[model samples]
Target chain A: MRLSYPTNIRIIKVPCTGRVAIIHLLKAFEKGADGVFVAGCLEGDCHYQSGNLRAKKRVAYARRLLASIGVDPERLAMYNLSAGMGPRFAEIAREMTAKIRELGPFLQPSGRTAAPQATAA
Target chain B: MIMAKAKPLEEILSYLEGFQRILVLGCNGCVAVCEAGGLKEAEVLASALRIQNMQAGDRRDIQELSLTRQCDKEYLAELKDKMDNYDAVVSLACGAGVQFMAEMYTEKPIFPGVDTCFIGVTEEQGVWTERCQACGQCILAETGGICPIMRCAKRMMNGPCGGSEKGKCEISVLVGRDVDCGWHLIFERLKKLGQIGRFAEPALDKDWTLSRDGGPRLIIREDVRP
Candidate 1:
């Protein structure tokens, strides 16, 4: 089955979303990702027991980290779906893409505007 | 260990605002075990600062370094050559380490990244409780190995006080937690040890001058001096 998501959305897979530390999420924003989200295994079905649950907590912490730095916490999100749920992944990709569109470009550390999806293309 | 908590990002950011270069100095001593000012925490703070600077459209060169022990002059001297490379330092050490860094780098602005919370022990993974007050006098032997000066709300030498009830301190009720009464703990432990009769000896008033009231006391053991 060939499932297609928004072109603006990029996916970076990991062994488990638990591996996604708060620093990684913040680094994404620092490197000019206007929006970032984590897609973890379903809440209780993580291959490494409680890995997804830990990811959920990391997502919450990342949101607080974003808010602390004056960035909109809404730009970052967490979604959980089993590996068989391709439609769910596509759905979240579309959802997060729309959110970034609403947020537009973020400010870069060099006092320059980050290139948005359209500008990057 | 001296337990501490990271300062709010906003407060820490306020210190770095307008500074182009920053050094996040971390201590791997008591603060590390407390999960407040370790190398990992220093890196986290640095990342947060970078993100914050990016959001604010400002540039900052933030470096993270964790010393073996920031309170020691030898460990601090390791950074002497690199100290001039930054505009300011955000020390993630205990109050003592922060002061030592300030004294060592007189020209560089030093800011605290963590608030020195208390002299306590980790009761569990995330819970810490005060265990000592360093009152310049030891009375644990009399109190069944519990220091009332640290555990007691009022530092009572002999008491559960009039406000104690149900073996809990009144301050505990106000703080929305059941804090064990220091005197009650003492009495129970002494009774358990068959030493309750030793309570006949009245405890003398603690000398206030020996504490912080005298403004930073110092102990010099000349025999141990190198």
Candidate 2:
């Protein structure tokens, strides 16, 4: 099925969401991404057994780390969906795009603004 | 191994307010084992500082370096030429390592990126509990291998104080968790060894001089001083 999502969203593929470390998430904002999210296999349905669950914990940890550094924790998020959920993926893309837009550009601790872009990795 | 935790980013950043060229140093010794200060942590800190500086509209040069052991003079010598390039250094080593680094590089200010907690063993993947206080005395043989100095909220040489409730130390209330009473563990261990009678024998007052109370202690082992 052909589906269209927000064009501002850039998707980066990985072997599994669990491979996404806290540094990777912070790098997105460091490089000026307004928002970043990880879309993994549905809960308890990870291909590598518990990769998605691990990713969930990492995402939460990254969120807290961001907050500690004065970055908005809401800018980072995690989502779980099966491989075949094309429509759901598109819907999430749209939802995230709107959320990032509302949050405006990612602001550095020093009050400077970074260009707006949303990333899903 | 020595256990430590990363200092808050805000605190680390505070130490670098005026510094433009900075090095976030990591040690691959005890700190690395505890997942506190290692190559990965150095990279994380460097990245965070860069992002913070970028937001502040300032151009700062931040780099990452990890040594085999910052406490060793040989390992710290690796920074000889590199130290000249940075205005300041943030060490992710324990308190001792940080001081050692500062001693060698007298010109540049060295800040601690992690707060050294204690000598401990990993209880699990992410949990670390203190195990040793380095009191300069060996009492484990008599205590059945459990240390009261580190485990007991109040270091009681001859104890199982009145505050012990259901095997938990009374201080557990303040910590919001059941902390094993060290004496209780000692009692149980002695019972299993058929030496429960030893528990009643009053231990002599501990020699405070052997511990930190006597100030900084040193051992010059001639055999190892090559």
Candidate 3:
């Protein structure tokens, strides 16, 4: 892919991408993240059984969420890489950085448009 | 069984800050999947409200309830007598469920305590994604089981919107990431099937009329009628 992303792209290395909750991604967006990405193992090569699959499914779900609120689901991504694929990790980071550049900084609330300011109780 | 979670402590706190008597309500369905505002959520919100009230010296009434479902008539009917007791409600249910509660009890003020994120599954421990947009049109057969409507940044039924650069969304004006456009997924599938030409089939315009648009929709089956 022909793209470059900002260095602000944070890499959260987890034991397994499958363990990354949707809320974590939403929180990232809520806190004003422009984009989010998850790197996992190849289908048959996951360290834990099907961790990559789980991560992929989670990514797909989140992608749609990003789209629903107009941020474009492409902002959230999932990729597969083995522990030794330093190249793959770097590639993902580079690809993500490029995408974020195209997408620019996040605008509006992360998940949903800000609700009409609720009156303080 | 998809689990849902509630909003952070602060989101609800800000909404409830001005109310004098706040009622925290929970549902037993989908929202309970990730613990957003199920019974546990109600308790947590109740406790949090007390803490906030003490801090502010507002001392809101802060009543609590975990109904079978705030979306159902029978379940909401259970709240009639209890409704008159509180000034407002802090709901932990999905938006529809919360609205049903408000509709059933017109006098009580209602507020959503959880954001309805999406119609998705728990792919792993905590990850939920855009599985179904409820576009009222489903075309999962042509592509691999992956849903283009929900996963694609653009809701293009056929092909990726012009924005897909490298398996990511071009719309990311904020955090530019490689475009893995939804069409990219469909293209990958067609490549596997050796039928890239099939992209010409026009995806019918989605009909959202079947969704929440009709306002206060209800479905009752003859077999399940109580």
Using DockQ as the measure, the top candidate is 1
Candidate 1 residue lDDT tens string, A3-105: 8878765567688887887767777776777778888888778889888788788889878877887888988888888888988777777777877776767
DockQ of each: 0.60, 0.55, 0.02
lDDT of 1 at A108: 41
Across residues B1-226, which tens digit of lDDT does each residue of candidate 2 receive?
Answer: 9999999998998899899999999999999999999998898888878877766778999999999999999999999988889999999999999999999999999999999999999999999989999998878888889998988878899877899999999999999988999999999998898878776688877887899998999889998877
Better of 1 and 3 by lDDT: 1
Give a tens-digit lDDT track for model 2, residues A8-49. 676778888878887888788887788888998899898789
Say which docking band candidate 1 falls in. Answer: medium
Task: List per-prediction Cα lDDT, in the order shown.
Answer: 0.83, 0.86, 0.68
Which candidate would rank higher by DockQ, 1 or 2?
Answer: 1
Q: Per-residue CA lDDT of candidate 3, range B35-105, in tens?
A: 67788667655754553454344546877789887778998888878777888898888988888888887
Cα lDDT tens digits for candidate 1, B1-226: 9999999999998887778889999999999999999998898889888877766666679889999999999999999999889999999999999999999999999999999989998889889988987788788888899888888888888767898788988898689989998999999999999989757878877787887888899999999999
Give the CA lDDT, 0 to 100, for residue B102 in model 2. Answer: 95
The candidate scoring highest on TM-score is 2
**Highest lDDT: which candidate?**
2
**Residue B113, candidate 1: C-alpha displacement in angstroms:** 0.9
Q: Where in model 1 is the C-alpha error above 4 Å? A: A108-121
lDDT of 3 at B67: 88
